[model samples]
Target: MPNYWGPFAQLKEQTNAILEVANYNGLMAELNDALFIDRSDIAYYVDLAKEAGGPILELGCGSGRVTLPLLSGGYHVTGVDNSQDMLDILSKRMQHRSREEQSRLTMCREDARNFQLGNAFSLVIFPYCSLLLFTDPADRKSILKSVRRHLTSSGLFAFDAPVQESLNQERIFELDLPIESGKTVVTLGIKTYHEQKVMLENSLFQVAKSTNKRYTILEYKKLALFAEGELEQELQEAGFYVYKRIPTLSDNGKTLRYLYVCGKSDTDTYPLWHPYMPHNQLPNHVLTLVSGQGCRVTDQHGKTYIDASGGLWSVQCGLGNTYIIDAITKQLSTLSYGTLFAGRGNEPALALARKLVELAPYPLEWVYLTGSGSESVELSIKLARQFWHFAGLANKNRIVYLDQSYHGTFFGSMGVSGLYPAKETVGPGLPGLDCINAPNPDNCPPNQDYETYALTCAEQLETVARLKSDQIAAFIIEPVLGSAGVVIPPQAYFDRIAEICQRHNILLIVDEIATGFGRTGAWFCSTHFGIKPDIMLLSKGITSGYLPLGATLFSAEIGNRLLAHGAGIMHGSSHNGNPACCVAALATIDVLTNQQLIKRAREAGHYVRELLEQMKNEQPNVSGIRSLGLMAGVALCQNDHKPATKEQVAVIYELLKRKGVLAYPAVSSVVFFPALTITDDELQTVVQKLGEVLSSVQLVNNGTRMR
Candidate 1:
């Protein structure tokens, strides 16, 4: 009655009807019998522990989510859970298994918040949002203190909790409450307020199937939502220091859940504006290019702005090109879409694979196709792991990435990507990823040339390899840092990284999702950097952003190994290798080669760099400028020599929007990614408008006048 039980009491009552009508206890028992007890979570944690070489303890191991599989994997697992019902289920499951499995599992019935077993654990886990169950601040503090005590000196405590914003939103709790079977009427409820530290009230409504029975009710008292800062402060207060708060999903830049890694002494904080930040303040608009001729596009608004940013930095042949449109139209007429599974393949899929192989720098002979950049990155990691298993290097399963690099949005990609802001809203991602600091040639130690900075960054890769050694299976990086302020490394940076991977027997993967298809003045950024990675990931510009298409190109050696082991890769999607998307990519490549757009990109990039340099010199507020082809970053500095203030950057961005120019601020800078084929006159118009915006905006620094 006092709301002490939180949402669980409501959940029980709401489910009572289903239980009473359907023999709930019997159904639950049957479910327990036939459930097969999914051990994937356990297998995952076990694999992580094995890789980390740890004696691990899993807290809140409800229904043996991570305990049973760890036992099956032959890892010594000590599982702790507060619920006797869940532990009873796990005990029954273990009893049915062989003696060998039962030997590896140890169970303790105790509250995770204050339990201690008199032994230190190398890895401690609080899985499945179990930490969020502690609504009281004191209880949460006690849990963190207990975890710290249980962890060894160098142990890591990994846990997950629903993000505060995720809980504040109405959708998460707005589930449809079921009704009698006659009409299957249901009610959807949403939490609206919180009171008295534990009381949460919600608004509810009901709708009937086949009949109109809709109503709204003010439902009261549900759950507590903790802000991001509150969670961090609590952890810090309890003797635990958080290093990473990894997001669960990062598609359009919002994450609902977070996976936090904390340790006793691992107190490290990074610059807050990583890719996973959920601040959607940028004024983004889609310009519908209704018609075009050659490399020009006429938008529906009748105002053409040279298709800069290339429709998310992909359109290499410009927009509304006849060649690509015709190819796509033809493909839709012939075979719009088809499944590539079960040895069945389409002409477009095969032809596209061959084309990628032909164009790849090294002996990349095989291709795996997907629908987007995220899918491509996921497939690359899966393939790398599979290859390691096939080659009998079971211990080699870790992925290494660079900080501030944009990989993709899938769970695995989110784990490997270094953009924290983009993933902040999304909660806990796949585990077993290591991120190293990326090279910033423009902002590195003063007096060091870009080339020297590149070399130093490449050496960091060797440092990671030496530290992790045989545990690392692959190293993935973008040839030029794309999402993190469009930072570009020196020419020799990627080349040296490739050499280091070769020396360490770690597969090198290059993500060219944004920079491929002439976005970086070449067919691929890897080509411009003069490095041939063992695996090449491509999307975006592949289809000129007309359709979603991503491909993972593998070297001949890895391809042959996979082929010899099996007929095809194990993973796929419903829209994998869509014929229409394939045709779009093929047409896009054809346009780039036949129209010489890649060459245009190189020349245009040089021109844009010169213009930006002129602007930087003229505008004192301009801190630094870096450009590679159409991708550029114009960093604005504050009077205090710090990064530009959000308000200042926002003013400049809004001014550009009003002046018919479109660009977004990245970190402490504005990203300028115009289409590759803009004419000289059109390019001048963009710069002139930008100059006008800067001139009008008041700045913190005096004598830094915009002309």
Candidate 2:
């Protein structure tokens, strides 16, 4: 009675206690064998135990099915179950085993969600949809959190859940177990769902033929079904990194269930300092980046590595440029804090805005400052809706986003998001938000060319606009899709998109969060497309990782319309025009222009691109390599050309880290957004170490690297 509510409540009300405790007296064990003795699970666990060197903690160990096998396989096993009857049966069975075997087995009757053993384990396995017993996601998360706290640093947590589609819906499945010579105990299971919660009516009979003597067990289980890529997202959020997913097979060797094997992500950054983490995972290590010069940063551990991702694709002038640092220091001492509220603004903010307007493409002249990338998106969305509202076009309220493009994490920002797994936990976002398929060459149809695919993607937006032009406000896109493994669109894609948006009188927004400030060869990735977007969002490199600063650059026409009729736009952060951030951004721009790093980025980016291309040619696992300036990604694949598995991704990332190269990891690719100032020598080491990492990541059948 843990204060169950929602879906969990539905399950508790449906369950009958007599049914739950009608219990197992060796009949359940025999019935399990008759149903489908999935010995593959046994082999899988044994292999994992051998590799992880486990003293296994088995949750929901009903009648010691897998537990007995594990003990026989030389594993120290602890079996915990909520059912005392099941544990009593297991204890009786264990009496016949040898003294050594008995010593290896430990039993406890406890619930998986709240059980504690006072010792950490290398492997924790919750087999047979025991997870489904906890109907609430919070309860399941609690169990997972407990699992993490009880696991060794290098340990693995694993579980199996029957797929939603495979749950017996027809009620025709049966299992027969013989007790005496002629008498048989038969169990027929009838599975049904009420409001998405599963009910299994298991009727046990004294004999195979029906005579009306039967005992019924009403088993109620509710589980959160995972979407295509959602389990990975959930696992990461819960502080576990899923390394592998193995199929749990039935007696006939067909796939009856799926198992996830995960390791605790090293994220104990517990001093309450998680500033800009996107995925809600705790930081792996609380790294106070002590000091740096050029493109390398030193952690408190005295270890240094290339600032590969530029500290979240910022730091355009590289780390420790004393010019920018001195500028920030001076600004902090001077006009340290200034608010741009109530028609009051600072000199630094106005100056920076003026400089950006001058540097931007001719169409985008007006600027709106913000605190971060997500805030910039929020402001842009607000500006779009308000512009139409003040202009008497309030019907146009929706925003369209490209599939797989990460705009930001704000409510309105995530509302127009396309990657559902990432935002599924967030509440239902703003109404009238829509998304169209992005132009991904990798996702191009087998019958279509790249240009055809690009135009097709453009047409999808047009169709949406045509169908709901009055409801649509703007169509948003990322110049280079960053979190979707740095996917680059076709050359003519943006031009077509611009034409369509103009025809429909829809504002076209481009997010240059990761590709701005010379990370791309151009000053802005929007410039690479040669399309002046109606509204443009910028961040990341704005203050060069020195401070949080962002901007929304839009056309003067929209600004004029909004500022008309005494309609003041109500959007501003408290530190909107903070002078310290402004000066750091000014100095960052000065460093980029004076050093000609944008041009240098073009040159250095070419060298890095060529090196990665050569590596791609030499490696069998390399599927594709994409780069626009210093922003780059190398996709790893198996023999079939599909993206690499998480285990493969982990192997590659771990090796790169060991070789003193830090890279941003995606689901299937390793991304690089190293500082534009990264040198040829660093690039050489990057290529060489990458080769070594690829050479070392050949996975074998035994779940270890091939020697």
Candidate 3:
């Protein structure tokens, strides 16, 4: 039997036509007609270039579809192609243009895989399936590495490649492919399939009839189909930060393509956010704790662990509070659901909004409700972009986030999150989001002072803005670093970060999802840092674990801007502002304020930390203990100064669970997040259980067990 993969492989080798016949103008025309390029796509690319602020370079510019338009729009563009014929065509096109337009166009003939321009560009584009040419993984990695070296410190690199599923099936030959004016008789023959690289080679025969004469042309094309995790790994290996992967404008499943936008790593700035773990993982243990009076929870298993982590770091009044339960029950009986679109209003939502505005820091008057933290983050991005449009800075749409920060996991939010591992499996996400290093007091670089580290980390925001000035719409962060091991920053960190955002006119979005509603013993974590952000992301604690809800609290300035412009922010989830959820939040807030759980959380956190510290001192396996309010991380030490293995950590975790103390193991450390309303006795018991587990833990090194 003839090998089908062999034919495609041979076809790609034979089709080496110089793309010179396709000029920039011709390419644009093809894109406009063939690819369905519209005003929105143009606007998005233009804004991307503006934010990217590049002396731009287009790798594999083949006929200049994107480069020419950008040049015509007054952007400095350098078009690179290995084929001299293509560059000749570009040169001719540039010469035909006016002198001013010609000045912005530069052409270079070089292999994209190894090309270097001796300098970096603010933006580098590999448009129109150009990335498909590199069938070798090493070549792709090499091209990305070279591209990374050619990018300005804060510049962006954008490209599009075919999706794996789109080309996974066997290629079929079509007799005639419809085209404008006439039908082009076309024949496609797959010659080879390189399964390792997911690349296929195919021969295309175009037979066009003109003046009743048949003209035939045979072209060999290499179609490289990128799997979900492949491109990201290559980009990472090449030193480019993979920021976004947007779906292709063309919805044809057969030609699935994604737009990848990346940039160079700069200094750490925004809070590192966590990517969303898929729902398929272990079901979130929802312990319906029955409680009353103050904040307390007893699980159905008849085991009660003081709420330390504060139900998902929210649940300010702890769990099973009567007021919140009653409020939710009452609201459910009346109006359970309502939409918040097109001027639609619900009484409970309005009341909750009003109450949030009253209690929010720094005149946060505009309230946007979401179903979860991820949704809230997405809304915040939309609001920032919309605000920029409203303020006539439509070009500023890039957002910056911190490294290792844990934001809600959604496609848009995941693009901004720094936890690469969680997002690695998921396919391409949104574009134009940037990340910087975050201040980690626990893991500060040796010899660097905390103040210096904080300033240096915070200043990365300004650096990113200056590098990509006029393009940044907002800087989002969490007041206290959560998820990437709860690494708290110095007191001056957030204050300086706020100042940097102020200096750059960038909207500062504080993700208080895990730190708000008295999680840090203050109404919001920002209060602990003595700073107020332009927007506050509140969730988890708002309803004290009774309902699912999140809020994007906006400042009066932004609210007035939106209202004055009559701009209705068209972003919300279906379950947004659920009446029952809102009522739960309202009642939870009442309980938190009336019963003073925030104060208690503060006092309890102090006591818990002291106990954890004493336990650490007595236990050999316990290395470090850090706490902020009710949130805490216990770092397990190794016997011989080696890092604790996952299996070792798992063993410790199993031991703790067996002792009836439930805790989460994060990477190499065990997280101790009990409820805020945990009694002093319960706190001691947790400390004792943790200590017992550590003391009994058998240290195994090199297959030998040690006491």
Candidate 4:
């Protein structure tokens, strides 16, 4: 944690110069005799080491200050420092100890900011104010992450930092320790304050006590400072929770320092913000996925489950596909990475774009590559407004989305989303955005047929378009709502919607991020509906989750006009059209086409639907079932036919997990999106397990009580 030679090479040089003085041959002994003579902190650190149960790692351990004491206390210690001179000094002291005592100590010269011990420790200690030396935020983070990696799951990371009051002023002092009858080691300490930190400089010299004459300079040293609370926040952000803080005062009773004891929040300290997941209630036993093959994934516990979620509805070609992996490997060897910006293009990007257009629905002649589904949706919104701006309809900038729809999680994309909670949680929605109810067959009137309900829903779009035609830029919809329990619209719905949008000059936007790449028995859901959208969003299965990639496809009518505009598409991502991602996408498409997975998806859809229908027939709790190709959901309900509670949905999924099936729970339903290549036996096993789980959870009287 000390600055070392990184930005304080002058300090290192000063130490080297003082070491070269022939008069100061025994400098190590002088340092311990003068500076650390009355270090009351050693006992406290020893007790912590006992509680932590070493072998311990002491970073930035100068000489044998803390390391030797810990070794003497019958504990194994590994001393790491960036200076070889300090390690050599510690090694020299170790030679004087017995063989067993020497064996308890190990010294390694390594940077405190970055080091690989290739070993785990029970306690990792950064004594002194070493952590404060790392003023750079990146360096501090690196050190904390390193400590976390080297610690055992139950281990502790303890470090002492100076208090803000300690560094408020500068002070100087001198200490004399008798080395012999007439000779003494004199230590001069000087402290200074800077903008946010304090610097301590110490110089050691040998002098005659009687004459008070300086003999030779033994060593010159500098230490770093840190502010209080700064380190605690950094520790939490780095996935560590400080359970204890032991404050200690200086020998003069003026300065104060605190020793923080931290433990890993959990083995999975990713600090990742999972979408739609509540942070406070995160399960301690969360599944740690390690590896996967085909339609099954194995957790860290070595248990395998049928990946019914298909990696969030993206792994259509299955997990660990070699074709995609090899394509990515090959692309990495050749280009590695290249951006499609300022007209600079890579081979894989160009080839992937051409391939997308070839397989895309009719008139989707151009592809704008992005980094992910959210980015794709975000770019599409920008492009839509850009087109209207070019066509002299600058006022046509309003975006309309359907209710219960999830487009993406970006600002503009989330703004156009219809989920109430999503909008409320994100604060404000983008201006000029509106929402209308989607065509859900389940929500139809009692007497209306499927077509009549579809027409009724489609009329909402016409009403909005007519009322806000001057402001409505585009109307976006997911052919099948994947996130909202995989709601499948009636066939008549898209036919009516396309007619209405075209008549009102409202651009139709299709978001097939989840349903794309043959998930719904076709390349894209727009094709199945026989509707040509002016713009389309795609991701997830584009590369089958091999890498991050997304695309926004545009029809000729829009692509050409946007191209002719002088302003151009005013946007791009740093990794947009990344070569490796493009290659993975290309390989995924090839796998889908060559292996005829699209045809298999259709066959799988038929098999899944039949099985789900039987499960529904057998269990009254299985009140509703809806599916399209590989994506399917079974809604659980009470005996009176009301939607199940959130608790009930959780219980159902836990049962499914216990039965070796991994399915996602969306509201009151359990959704399954198995890999396209999943065998019929696997599919039957998953559905059978689900049925068993559904039959076990029966509500008595619709009061939310399960038997």
Candidate 5:
């Protein structure tokens, strides 16, 4: 015997086994037909079928009682049941119908709680008290979720179950009914009631008059008697609402049942799995955003927080900009979508491409558009290899990227991601990819000047090129290692890298996805280092997160060469240079330029660095501060000089969130990517709250302090 500790310990183990009637012998199914074979219940479901149209899914469709009638009524039906014996009988009955009628019916022997038909249905029905068979609340939730996934956007899910209050007592009853050919069936049902559930055990007897022989079988069912309002709450949690409810009588008014016509909830009726989050769990710190304006966003609870991180380093022009919104709405009315393929183009796409060329550096006279940053990086990889291939140097297909660099999330871009967790489990990525250490100041050798350390890291790239120049196509680098916690290398690093790549005849691919459109105070971060890239990647701030758009701008020489190759481009997206997205980008650039936010970003950069410096003086946890324009990162450490642990960082973030400051925690650093339009007071409020959080933060486990 095992040790037990609760008042319900006695109920932990019971000798009476739960009945598996759904898998029982064929006689039980016949007995089921005899006991409740009143085909009168069919009329109610038939009326429901008329409301919820065809392409219906019937759960627990035992022996096709409800399904057969629905199918005969000119409705398309797919039946799901757990018992193969029951399904076999249904199949035998289905064969009697015409081939045309049979064609409309599909049958599957699978559990209702977990089934994947890969087809959406207009209506899903669990008729005849089928849902009550699942006595466990968890099983009910799972079955409801399965129904949600199989429903169309406007679909209906219907089911009927006895009201919990109706199962208040125990009763015994016996019924005898005649079947075909001098046969009689008798069923004895004994109902036993518990606090939360009721069990019905039945002994079914079949007798044949000619042989004077009888056979008996034992079967039982356990049904949940949910507490008041328990099922309604569960239904809401499962992303559904009872659109209509009808109370009806069953078993001669002794039992009260409810017919639930549930519709999918408009707001997140189905659970959505966010990127990089585990499918089985949700982050405790995550919030459902309901609305946003300026540099603040309100959660579902109506509490607003400063949008300091600018929504994953996008949203440069701030949220709810009227200019961008108007452009998008107008473009949608003018041209909802237009193909940029097969020599077809829209005015907005053409205008946006021209605007990009005008703003880009010298010799970057041509542009190709994509739908997002990931798509842009994927296109760059293909173009890099294709450029060499068309130039008759097919062997120069190798690409190089820096450590701690994040390009995008697609397979091609993921292969080049410096963060191991992003690509480790899902690789081997593209071949011929190499990684050089990122020129981070924190990683510089002791007493070594920052410029020399940056040059040394840049030299590592030249060394790789010298040894593999014949096989190299391009070297990709982000202006700053954005996802690597905003590691800003010295300007000398890019100066040396540009000279080395040009000397080695290797194309330079600069990924300004996170740092473009004034995130770094300039039009592009590449301009700050004065390096003219052979190819430039742009996104994120391009449309200020108002829309999704990305661009790949190439030097005139490379563009002319590819154009002369005559096969057009080898890659393109269906929504490449979508007109609405193009106009959003155009309006975003207009806002940045007209508002002079780029210059404001430079001013904000200095102000933030000064505030962080003051905060560091008062709080000893801040080990370092790195900033460029509005993007900045404050590195945190313990007294022993080790980087702060993830738990410690999470505690600080939770504290910050409580104070209504939303910031991004990358690795050991709390990075700020505030909107360029953020006011001085808003910026100060975020930094001051963060300082308070750092000061009061308790060290985990070891209890060490920075001071």
Candidate 6:
């Protein structure tokens, strides 16, 4: 201590100077002492900028405090300030950089309240409590208005301000930070309250031993302190959504500062590392989901959105159910895994299979389990072929599916799907798969009512079956088409297809990946039409998204025949009937039965249909609005009732997402399959937002209006 204090004892010339704060007053003051300006927490700004994914607009970019770091991090930054001297100093610092690095930083002496760059920016940041400089409410509104215009479609605007939690309490702080060799800055600050704002007055002493130089300066600053939750409300009224509010700790370990991250109300889309997607089309950083409760999921940045599609139309019991979680936890802790291989078995698998037989709406059955819907569908294809081959009809092995229908993406399942786009990429799938027309009442041929259209499409199945009558092993169809964009045909359509399969001696397979588990107002939508398929493919809401489980259910007769043939169903999965997953399915089924969610789905369906009627009346772009049991689709079209182009449907999807109502985008329609447990009020809100957005995009094309 003695050596440290006495090292700079040599006499030197004394100097006095005043170092003003960044925004002293309304872009009026000049910072003459740039070297002594506060430079704390500059790294925090840089990290936040990286999260935002710029081009960035930095307000009050004094002394290149946060700008240089942002530029170095590969972000294009435009620094705006009202101080010419500050801009000049920052400009001088940039002189040594190469052309490319220099191009990343833009300097301008413009007021934050009003400036027009004539372009959009992804992130607009006001660092270092600069937002507090705008004391006037009008000034704040004007600044936000400008920011809103300059923001991109999904852009964010962030700023920080002092919380001043200890305003009335007396506070004293002394800080000595070493800058360079033999030089130190010592600040003694006294905080006082004036006009309900914190005023900081400090005496700074700078001394250097190598040059024997000494300097003393007086600094004074005042800020309009805001209360917690006060800024969030103001931001909302200014057309910005409060994304996150973070409290930053002070040097004394007290949280006296806060950072408010905000986004425009029209913001949409974030970085997501998606599978089976082109990398160039994805965002820079995927959304970090933190917690999910009910149908809503909260991301890491504190943004919450409803999973209306029931997490791929399978979250039958909603999410975050304590009973389901407890069941999985208990099973995992006791017996995490067990499989149906080498004659091995577990209690959960047998218990669930027994439960399925009891709950089934058809004749007594046998159940085969797998890990996912694709696996189940793939197994169904194999089982159908196996059943025929064992029955002495080896040539009857072709699979048939309704046109525009989607089963799964595995080779056999994909071969049976009629979705051309998905099949185009992985073409030449399993060979003998035939197609039949799926009923689409909305797009009925001219002068044909829905019944006529239904019959016309259903007859295609008979046509294909007659041509390849003995060659077709089974006819697979979704009671209500799911991945082809929520297409729901009339009951007669499925009934006719079932009748055809029965007559042709081909097994009828129901693919219920999206429509099973009480999603369509019934335990199984095939029951809604009063018909039973010879075989059924089930997954998705089976585990309510808690775990993966797929099952293929066969009638007693087919099960007996398949088992009687020599080697008793020569198929086994590594994870067939996984105990933990089976337990999850059991819990999910218990929840479905105990909560009476299926009945509520029907009730909510009526509520949703009424709302859709209103939407059809108000939104000119809404041509065909279909709603059944909380599952709906609003197909866009020309006034002539022609299907809208795929591009237009994508645009509608973007608009809905920007408004925070996420819907599945289909070929030419937006799929609306909210959870069966969704409240009436939530349904109403979704309809209102979707209707409002649809009404806004009144486009005209091909000599026809959107309606």
Predicted structure with the largest lDDT when compared to the true one: 5
Q: Residue 402 in model 5: shift from native, Å?
A: 1.3
Clashing pairs in 4: none
Error of 2 at 257 (Å): 11
Per-residue lDDT of candidate 6, residues 35-89 (tens digit): 3245434545564564455699988887676777777777899999888877877
Clashing pairs in 6: 271-286
Candidate 3 root-mean-square deviation in Å:
24.7
lDDT of 4 by residue, 1-707 (tens): 23222213354455543443422345544445445557656766786676566589999888767888799889999999887777777788888899999888878889988899888999999976678767677888999989989998767888886665565344445666765334655545546456535465555555654546445454434445556566667887887877566665574766567777787766454566566666632333267799999999998778899999998789989998898898899889999989877779998899988998888887789889999998989988898898999999999999888887887778988877676354676576688887888766556676888678877878888888888858889988898886667787877888888888778788888898998999989988877778788888899999999899999999888877866764678779789989999999999999999999999999999999999998789998877788888889887777877777776777678668867899998756889888899999999999999877666557534322222
Q: Name the 10 consecutive residues with the lowest summed lDDT in model 6.
A: 1-10
* Candidate 5 to truth, TM: 0.62
TM-score against native, each model: 0.58, 0.66, 0.57, 0.62, 0.62, 0.64
Candidate 6: where is the Cα deviation over 4 Å?
1-153, 156-273, 284-288, 420-422, 702-707
lDDT for model 2, on a 0 to 1 scale?
0.76
Q: How many pairs of residues collide in each model? A: 24, 0, 36, 0, 0, 1
Indicate the worst ten consecutive residues by lDDT in candidate 3: 279-288
Give a tens-digit lDDT track for model 2, residues 1-707.
12333333454577553235345455545545444463467667766675566699999888777888788888899889888888888898899888999999889988778777889998999887677667677787888888888898768898876655555543444555543223344434545454555444344444332444344333333455554455577678788886677877553655657788888876655546463454334444335578788788787677887767777778788888899989999988988899999878899999999998987865687998899988888888888998888778999988998877777778877776565355656556688787888876667777988888988888998899889968888888888887777888876888888888888888888888788888888888877778778888888987788899999899988888966767766787799979999998999899888989899889988998899999889887787888888888888777666667766776677667657787877646788888878889998888888887787555443232422
Winner by TM-score between candidate 4 and candidate 1: 4
lDDT of 3 by residue, 453-499 (tens): 88888888878989998999999888766666667777777778777
Worst 10 residues of 5 by lDDT: 1-10
| Tens-digit lDDT track of model 1 for 561-662 | 887888467789888988999999999889889889889888988998888888778776677887888788888776666667665676576557546666
Residue clash pairs of candidate 2: none
Candidates 1 and 5 compared: the better one by lDDT is 5
Candidate 2: worst-modelled 10 consecutive residues by lDDT: 1-10
Model 5 CA deviation exceeding 4 Å by range = 1-270, 283-285, 420-422, 698-707
